[model samples]
Target: MILWFTVVQVVVAVVAGVLGIVLGLAGRRPSDLSVGGLALLELLLIAQIVIAIIAPLAGNPPTGSLLEYWVYLVSAALIPPAAVVWALLERSRWSTVIMGVGALAVAVMVWRMQVIWTVQVA
Candidate 1:
């Protein structure tokens, strides 16, 4: 796992979360800016998925359970799209909050993935 890429992911997730909160508090629905941010996050997650797959083949497999790591990666990848769909259907300030929660969840999931990747198997 590339450390810098993980850092970038974390930053993006945090920014998305903050934007979501702001939008929600301001009583605004999902705007183009927020949607674009989520889209960027989705792209980053896809890139992470690709890197996670290739890194193992390149001789840098995770030290923890491979299944668990893949689960985290897949879940992280799915969050933004699901959130967008949910927000569209709900169409309210709560939708923004939902997106915020999803963004924060992605950040936590990414951190967990790093932990799983670096853990030493006894």
Candidate 2:
């Protein structure tokens, strides 16, 4: 994966996570700030998907197990929507925290995906 793009995703995810946790702890329910943050993060993941598709064709193909990289990428892309749905249904501070945790989880998963793409060998 592209290093700069991965860094952007990680940073966005971290910011989103921190925002959600801070808002939740401050007794805020799921609001635009929290939900919007995740939405933005998801958008970044989608961009990453597009990038991944094109990067290989551009002569930057991953050196790792393609199956593993794909699995991590796809799974990371799913987390935000799941967390948002959970927050909407539960409508509690804890749900907000869950979203935060989910964002953090995505961040970790994205990092792993990067490692798989750039470092791992098949």
Candidate 3:
């Protein structure tokens, strides 16, 4: 888990969570973003993916811990798309809950990634 990537993911998750809460409270879903949000997030995710790939190739500390890093990377990569689908399916107060779940998921995945990077494999 690169620090910058982690930070970006955390921030995005927070915003997504806040958006989810608002959507839930407002009784509506935000399938994707209004416009710019989705684009920016997509870009960020892409950057993160690139970095994730590089971390292993560049001989980052995560080298010995490929499994964990890969899993979390895949997890982090999935949240946004999942959020979009979930929000669309529940275009009501439940949308917020969807966002909340996705956002929190990102956070958890990030933590997992960090742990994987640091822990030695048996």
Q: Please report how far candidate 2 places residue 52 from its true position, in Å.
A: 1.1
Among these predictions, the greatest lDDT belongs to: 2
- Candidate 3 lDDT over residue span 82-119, tens digit each: 76666667567776576676776776677667666766
Over 4 Å off, model 2? none
TM-score of 1: 0.95
lDDT of 3 at 39: 42
Error of 2 at 75 (Å): 0.6
Task: Write one digit per residue (lDDT tens) for candidate 2, span 12-51.
Answer: 9999998889889988899888999899999999999999
Runs with alpha carbons beyond 4 Å of true place in candidate 3 = 31-42, 119-122
Q: TM-score per candidate, in order? A: 0.95, 0.96, 0.75
> Which sequence of candidate numbers ranks them by TM-score, best first?
2, 1, 3
> How many angstroms is residue 77 displaced in model 1 relative to the true structure, after the best TM-score fit?
1.1
Evaluate model 3: give its TM-score: 0.75
lDDT of 3 at 69: 72
Query: Please, what is the whole-model Cα lDDT of each candidate in the order they appear?
Result: 0.89, 0.91, 0.66
**Winning model by TM-score:** 2
lDDT of candidate model 1 versus the reference: 0.89
- What shift in Å separates residue 24 of candidate 1 from its native position after superposition? 0.7
- Candidate scoring better on TM-score of 1 and 2: 2
